[model samples]
Target: MRRSGATLDFDVDTTSGHPLYIPNGDLLTANKWHHVVFTWDGNVTGTNAKWYVNGVNKTLANIAGSGSRTSDSGYSPYIGALCSGCYFNGQIDEVRIYNRALSAEEIKRLYLLGN
Candidate 1:
């Protein structure tokens, strides 16, 4: 996650690699409430990855890299901030991780529940 003034660039790292990187611009703003969802099924390519904001599918955005993910980084996921110097400008509510990719319906329900 990177925030500069009014620009916010979000990235959803996949075990396969860095298949998710939302460019800096309109998809995400500087200050606002949002619910982000990223899903990638097992052994999938970058094109198969999916991400959403507020239940709206944003997977249409450009996703870099290709090929299947054979393994995940041994490191644990660090959200909101990649490191001490890279703290997210805003706040985060909650984060949940599942062993399997959630269906679109499930993601939408989560968004509805938040609202």
Candidate 2:
């Protein structure tokens, strides 16, 4: 997301069926250069999942889940601005994506640089 008069930008996404759910109350705000990248492979065979913000590993309770099963290997890749029809209102600079999930350290580095 972008803000008026800001130089940096932010972009984030996840793998297929491994959707990123940014709740209405949780909005990313940046005053300068910043970027966020998220990816998931939809590996649901095991009951394990993870979430990161600005490249930092967040606790499992911090991530939103369906409580049943979440996988990222589906055919259709889920990408958008907000969860459940909520549109982002800030100016977004750039967004990038990778087919595979990023390591915890990688996410932190990206987030630090963006911020």
Candidate 3:
């Protein structure tokens, strides 16, 4: 994902296939900080993945596929942005990754903690 002026770009993906790129819309405002959390459980129905912004659930409705991320991806996860020369133009703080997906309440708690 990326930040462009007042909008936040979003893309959902799994271990395989093309990424599900979501168009820029609500869930973000300009000149403010937001707590963003992405949770994916890999199920096709009944909440397979979610996107939370500022402790509110803002996951898009039309998720394309059964987004399943593999346990191991060979390369290590990189914070801030991707490695292939795609740099983030905005600031990032308190980034975290877990071996398992976090629940909504847990994400909200972390958001309230601010790190």
Candidate 4:
């Protein structure tokens, strides 16, 4: 997912041939900092993925299709933006990527730390 200005974008492509795309919405306030966290279990089902904005879980009502969440050899993680475009306009700090999925409590702690 990526954000441009206040608009947020979400996308998912499963080898099932059907891809999932979420509607664009305001995920950030102008000139204000926000804490955002995204997580996925690498599970085959999309149900295990999550989006956390300011420590609260956001709904993913638009998600559809089914496929493994296992890492794809074609894609690598990008911290501030997508490969083609949708570059972020603000500062990104203390970015972290983990090999293991973090628990809810750990997410909360990290969010609280503002790191």
Best prediction by lDDT: 4
lDDT of each: 0.64, 0.43, 0.61, 0.66
Expressed as tens digits, the lDDT of each residue in 5-45 for candidate 2 is 32212223333233233322332555533344544454332
Model 1: runs farther than 4 Å from truth? 1-17, 23-25, 42-44, 66-74
**In lDDT terms, how accurate is model 4?**
0.66
Candidate 4 residue lDDT tens string, 1-115:
6775675555555667534434335677878787777777655355676777777767655556576444467887655677657577788876778887777788888888875
User: Top model by TM-score, which number?
Assistant: 4
Candidate 2 vs candidate 3, TM-score winner: 3
Query: Cα deviation of 66 in candidate 3 (Å)?
Result: 5.9
Candidate 3 lDDT by residue in tens digits, 1-115 = 5544544444444555434433336666656777887776545432556777888777464455545654545755544444567666666777787778898889899889984
Which 10 successive residues of model 2 have the least lDDT summed? Answer: 2-11
RMSD of each: 3.6, 7.6, 3.7, 3.1
Candidate 3's TM-score: 0.66
Better of 1 and 2 by TM-score: 1
Give the per-residue lDDT digits (tens) of candidate 1, residues 33-85.
Answer: 88887776643344556667888776444556555554446655667666567
Ranking by TM-score: 4, 1, 3, 2
